[model samples]
Target: MPRAVRSPADFWSGALFAGFGIAFAVAALAYEPGRATRMGPGFFPFALAVVLSLIGLATLVRSWLRAGPPPLGLTSRPMVLVLGAVVAFGAMLHALGLAAALCFVVLVSASASSRFRWPRALLLAGAVSGLSVLVFATALQLPIPVLGRWLGG
Candidate 1:
């Protein structure tokens, strides 16, 4: 008897990963992928894509062998909110800076959950924003201003 997929989520995720990997690997070929020693623009991407494809293939095979919980159906509200949160981060990053953007994203995305609470969300936002600022700005010394131009940084 032929084995069937035991985990639809894993199967689909693997398919997506493999599909994108293959597409990226193919696209990488358009650029000059020099030898490993020399290294070209396409080499790193091509290599990563190949690895991604392999991982995806492995996941797909495992999906057929193991059982797992079914994938959750997508909800419009959460989807929109999550996606919008990302967009908001990008929009705010330049003017408000990384710190504010991080907080905004966390709060906005957190609101998508049914049990959303303002105080918890605020705490999370503060933690996330503070951590990001410490890592990206303080430690890495990235060019992004802490408060941004709008805030007179």
Candidate 2:
């Protein structure tokens, strides 16, 4: 059906994204040389910022091609859950540690799905969190904190 089309909202977001990228890229220019050749801590951020700015420019171009006013849709439930989990994860990172935090992240993320169930949530959360902890802490030596002082280092 050649039915309906919704106009895109303000291109300001693209501009903002581009602005953030520019800021990061500028900051990265000051990065000091590290062990691996010349690139240091700021290298990735600077590169990412440039990429973000390009994306923003592309989005702005796309927006300019659109015809008229746009309708932006926002949903409450999923937004609340995802944002809440992210905030909680940030807050709990020190105390709860990676394993616990990953569990929370996994379960909360899974719960965002309409098809999510308790059993699946539990299984997936445990498996994903466990594997993440093992790989990061053991294999990669990422210094991921474990839940308790006794259990982790």
How badly does each model clash, as a count of residue pairs? 0, 0
lDDT of 1 at 31: 90
> Could you say which candidate leads in lDDT?
1
lDDT of 2 by residue, 94-133 (tens): 7778888888988887788899999989999999888988
Residue 5, candidate 2: C-alpha displacement in angstroms: 16
lDDT (CA) per prediction:
0.89, 0.76
Off by over 4 Å in 2: 1-8, 11-69, 148-153
TM-score of each: 0.53, 0.55
- Single out the weakest 10-residue window by summed lDDT for candidate 1: 1-10
Give the distance in Å from residue 90's predicted Cα in candidate 1 to where it truly belongs.
5.9
Q: Which portions of model 1 show Cα errors greater than 4 Å?
A: 1-3, 85-153
